[model samples]
Target: MSAELDLSPEVPEPTLLESLLYNGFFLGAIVQLLCILAVIKPTSNWYEQV
Candidate 1:
């Protein structure tokens, strides 16, 4: 069984780094959200280009 929203193709095999990057995006997103909620995320005032 898998998550219902997964639309990615079912590859016969996946490289470790590929899996790591996939999970990293999700993990990093969660951490970023937490930081934002805690008001610890850097502000746009600190970076003009961003």
Candidate 2:
């Protein structure tokens, strides 16, 4: 019971490196999706530009 009541007040938050890593992976997924779409439809201007 004492241990449960003694929890630290500090809350875990994402660090800059963690945020960067998450965004990098997210961007990578979007790029991969675009590439796949481009393969399926080569004539679209958006796909061509990518």
Candidate 3:
């Protein structure tokens, strides 16, 4: 029973290119969100300006 339980399939680690692509995607998403916020923020203060 213990041996059976220990027979779970091993997960493969990510390769270097895969790691870089994942990190790049995450950073790109963050930067896109910040750019969107920057664009919306000025418009959001339109009432104050008026």
Candidate number of the best TM-score = 3
In model 1, which regions exceed 4 Å deviation? 1-10, 40-50
Q: Which tens-of-lDDT digit does each residue in 1-50 have in candidate 3?
A: 45555668898999999999999999999999999998877656577887
Alpha carbon lDDT of residue 27, candidate 1? 100
Give residue 7's lDDT in candidate 1 (0 to 100).
81
Residue 33 error, candidate 2, Å: 0.3
User: Could you give candidate 2's per-residue lDDT for residues 1-50 as a string of tens digits?
Assistant: 45557567898899999999999999999999999998998874776687
Better of 2 and 3 by TM-score: 3
Q: State the displacement of the C-alpha of residue 33, model 1, in Å, after optimal TM-score superposition.
A: 0.2
lDDT of candidate 2 at residue 49, scale 0 to 100: 82
Write down the lDDT of every candidate, Cα atoms only.
0.85, 0.90, 0.88
Local lDDT at 5 for model 3: 58
Which window of 10 residues has the lowest lDDT sum in candidate 2?
A: 1-10
lDDT leader: 2
Residue 33 of model 2 has an lDDT of 100
Candidate 1 global lDDT: 0.85
